[model samples]
Target: MAFQSIKHFALELDGPDDIVYSSGEMVTGVVILELTREIKVRSLRVLGRGVAIAHWLENRSVGVNTVYNDYTSKTIYFRKRQHLIRDNGDLTVIPAGRHEYPFSFQLPEETLVTSFEGKHGSIRYWVKVKLHRPWATVKKIKKEFTVIEPIDINTPSLLAPQAGTKDKMARIWYRNCGQVSITAKIDRKGYTPGEVIPVFAEFDNSTSRSVVPKAYITQTQTFIARGTMKQKRAVVATLCGDIVGPRRRETWHGRAIKIPPVGPSILQCRIIKVEYMLRVCVDVPGTSKLSLELPLVMGTIPLHPFGSRTSSVSSQYSVNMEWLRMAIPEQPEPPPDYSSVVTEEEAAQNSTAVQPEEDLSGVLQPSLLAYIQEFRSRPPPVYSEVDPNPQPITMRRRCMTC
Candidate 1:
């Protein structure tokens, strides 16, 4: 038999969760090589590689009337290799037995820390082991791993829950209607996977038209290339909606939207940026829809004191009542008063009739000016209206018999 000695080849990680890792952490694993009998090997090598690749297809106009499909691809990567056994001068022979070679590598400190797999692109990390032979294709084994960075939620701004409400009047479009207002609030603005987001909403449809409010969370990614920027948004999750009666208002409280396992916000990456937002909108037929948006921060860790509670029983409880405060109705601004503002016609008439400055010999006298200046320089007035000035009081008592 040509290849009777080589029995088995495998790779195993030291950690229990072999696929999970953090930046700058040491990764240790073992390469197992089992042989049926004595065998000769040239060398054994291990390599680690991290790469981000983006590829897509689009249609392009070729000539005056012809169109063609084109494909585009871009990649950024890093690779490290180490030799466990090198064939310096002579080949090494091993007796028939189970052999294990341990290897370790330290990931770069300042590197892309999150692993992402998406439809159009991917950020991947893997470790590969190869057994080199003279003139034969090298036998290889590869394993994928996930890398994540710590996103602390203890920051003062992130610790507080986020809520906002907006109201708008549709008089320009819906002239016969009054106003339509939508208020939406979330328990907190920052969250991680496995955490539930509590959403509370209220809608007031003062217009004559019926309104249906819809709310959803959208994840947007911005890709920058060659001085050009492109953006793509995908709906990650959705909340329930309610139909509001015409000229009526309704309130909804404590609707939970679970966050799925998705990549966190990627602000550290230069070419790629990820952001999430909560959008609340009302669909109005034959008119423009009213909508409100709130920025959401997706981190690697959920709010502290409650971590990884997706399977916990207490997560089913309603969020604090404070989250509902965002549903407060919008107050209309006071209408402008024409009396305080001079109109164009009135200004023109006054300008035409106004005379030159009149002589004020009596009012602008030296004595009068001096008196006014003296009065102005004097301290503020002090009145004896309370304790210093006493008022006479009369007291009367009713007898118990009466």
Candidate 2:
């Protein structure tokens, strides 16, 4: 095929700087093509490219010491070209100085993360222009730019478990051909008070190959109970047994326990129940590493009172429980009394009027006389011997004489 003569080609975009655009925004640009010789073209297309790259690095501090690191890279590309037309159409031949073509592409909305500031990472994108013609070779032009200010998104880490009642337990099962078979179970849903949830982790190496396995376990507990309420508690117990091809089972415990990572390994628990959540992670070390998490619900279920038993078995292993505590919600204190306050009418009716005795100064105060006159006019005072302090006989006689 004959090749087309060298032509002028350039690419430009609309949003090139630190422009903040959402995922659903339209990214637009134009590809200008100037041809020196008249050429018949076929079809043209615009393309948007997105890619993610990841790498890891390792450094050893000293002899027999090792460390590991990781890095990531991402990129995007955009491309578009003009279309040729045949038949009766309003297509004009290029006399070729500078040509302006408009192109547009839609951005994805889901790419925006709402969790972190500037949560959106940079996308190194490029625009490439390609010209295709029969009897002529294709020409190309390229330009590069970046998209910034994406929506902040917070995605929970795979190792981090959510805290709540609805969370579920996670179990992973995998097999290594002719080597070992592994089954791991984690209580991702969370634990109840006095409930001994089991994390059953098993590895079987029945293949002809001799295999050694290493495991790491981490448990976190948070006490959600407070005030006079007892704190939530958790305990993780691990047991390893060897089964050699129909041989009798040999169990290891306490000082007799010996695994690749030699030590007195005991499960760890915290006194304070986490108000938010707590995560327990287990990492198995091997060429193919697998990690899982168990979420412990803090104070959701009541801890059974002391010396209580349940008809439940260990969730991880089939171990019997001697005691179980029930979880209960804390009771609120009673409010204060507001029943003693009386209204104005009730106070007036319940009060008694005082009567004046024998004008001791030989003169009666008009205010006292007026009060006595008002009381007598309304009703006769009901005298009761129950009241030890009674009005004097002189007052009674004065009232009678009046």
State the TM-score for model 1. Answer: 0.66
- Tens-digit lDDT track of model 2 for 1-402: 224333556667764332323346566778776666655555344555543222223355776777653333332222333342332333334553566677776755544211110111222344566655554565666654433221111112321223211111122345433334444443233332222333344444444333332222222212111111121111122222244231111211111111111011111111121221222221222223222233332221122244433322222244333321121112212111111111223224433421211211211112323222222232211101110001110110012222
Model 1 C-alpha lDDT per residue in residues 243-262, reported as the tens digit of each score: 78889897766655654444
Clashes of 2: 24
> Which portions of model 2 miss their true places by more than 4 Å?
1-7, 15-20, 55-95, 112-123, 149-402
Q: lDDT winner among the candidates?
A: 1
lDDT score of residue 336 within candidate 1: 17
Give the clash count for each candidate: 0, 24
True lDDT of residue 52, candidate 1? 62
Pairs that clash in candidate 1: none
Task: Specify the poorest-scoring 10-residue window by lDDT in model 1.
Answer: 383-392
